[model samples]
Target: MAALKILGKSSSINVRKVLWTCAEIGLDFDLTEFGSGTPNSVTTPEFLILNPNAMVPVIQYEGQVLWESNTICRYLAARHQRTDLLPQDPMARAQVEKWMDWQATELNNAWRYAFMALVRHSPAHRDTAAIEHSVREWNRHMSIADLQLQRTGAYLVGDQFTLADIVLGLSLNRWRASPIAHANLPALQTYFDLLCKRSGYTQYGANGIA
Candidate 1:
């Protein structure tokens, strides 16, 4: 099989979702740097012709070009679904897509603030008020995820790991230690612990690279 090409940096959670999706599907990919507020090789004319945004995670697969993290993940799953990252039934797949959209519209909206404060800015230059605000909002959003997990089980799609779990897992990657209080949520903590066990996450999680 031809190896997939993903344009993006490893530090990006968005990129990592596609990378992780490839891993879960028993596929390998080549990633080019494109994010982290730094210019990347994908900005070249040849690359720009493929993805105008020149964003990391614009993937080339099956002779086609695709962008946006969740969309890329879905494409991968739909293309090679034998591994079960995506469901076989249409209803189940729709449910997964809904969670993926939530990851984009809801999770990213709340988490980016905390991520900027804790990961992007220097501790000395960090804004206490902004960080506090983000923490509250993130915690509140996390509660929603927590409730979902409690109502279901170990996985977001209910039992087995699916693309929904893979993508939502990426959006919440930073919450485990982002100065947020999650002491009351055992299910959420379990999900984090489970993700840490994956080889891709272990290699990436280690070194604080993401």
Candidate 2:
């Protein structure tokens, strides 16, 4: 089989999610950087052909083009039949997918403005009030994750680590790195500490990219 070709930069959290997933599955892949502070290849005609959204983390696997970070992780896990990473049972799969979706949608959306303003320091996102509001919301969403971790007392779904942890782990790193006040969510803190022990998190997540 041809090695998977991942098009994204190492500094990208979304791209790192895919990279960490590959590490967990012990799959080899080739990565091409197309992230911030580079010659914007994502907008180029050739790259745009692979992903209409022109996003980083677009992948070419088994002659099929795939985009969206979470979706790419799901495809790779399922394709390899890595039931440990992505469960085969329907309800178990849904449990993993639920947190993945939350990370992609609600959690991600909650932090955008604040992240751009405080982390990226983008001038266009300098609205003080909006940044404060975004920070509060971001913390609130993370609290939900903290509660879930408390309930599971291990990985997001249960004892075994799954795709949910792969996604949420990156989000947790982002929250920690972001320049916002955080609540005393001990469960989340414990969860983050647990994730840090993994080789994938050491290489791709805790590398101080965020």
Residue pairs in candidate 2 whose N, alpha carbon or C atoms collide under 3 angstroms: none
TM-score of 1: 0.85
Cα lDDT tens digits, model 2, 1-210, are 998999998899999999999999899998878866676578888988988887889999889999999999999999999999998999999989999999999999999999999998899999999999999999999999999989999999999999999999999998998879997899998998899899999899888878
lDDT of 2 at 73: 95
Q: For residues 71-147, what per-residue lDDT tens digits would candidate 1 score against the true structure? A: 88888888875547777788888888888898788877876766776777666537778777777777788888889
TM-scores, all models, native as reference:
0.85, 0.97
lDDT of 1 at 187: 82
Worst 10 residues of 1 by lDDT: 201-210
* Model 2 residue 126 distance off true place after TM-score fit, in angstroms: 1.0
Query: Which 10 consecutive positions of candidate 2 have the poorest summed lDDT?
Result: 32-41
**Candidate 1 — which residues are off by over 4 angstroms?**
36-43, 122-128, 180-183, 204-207
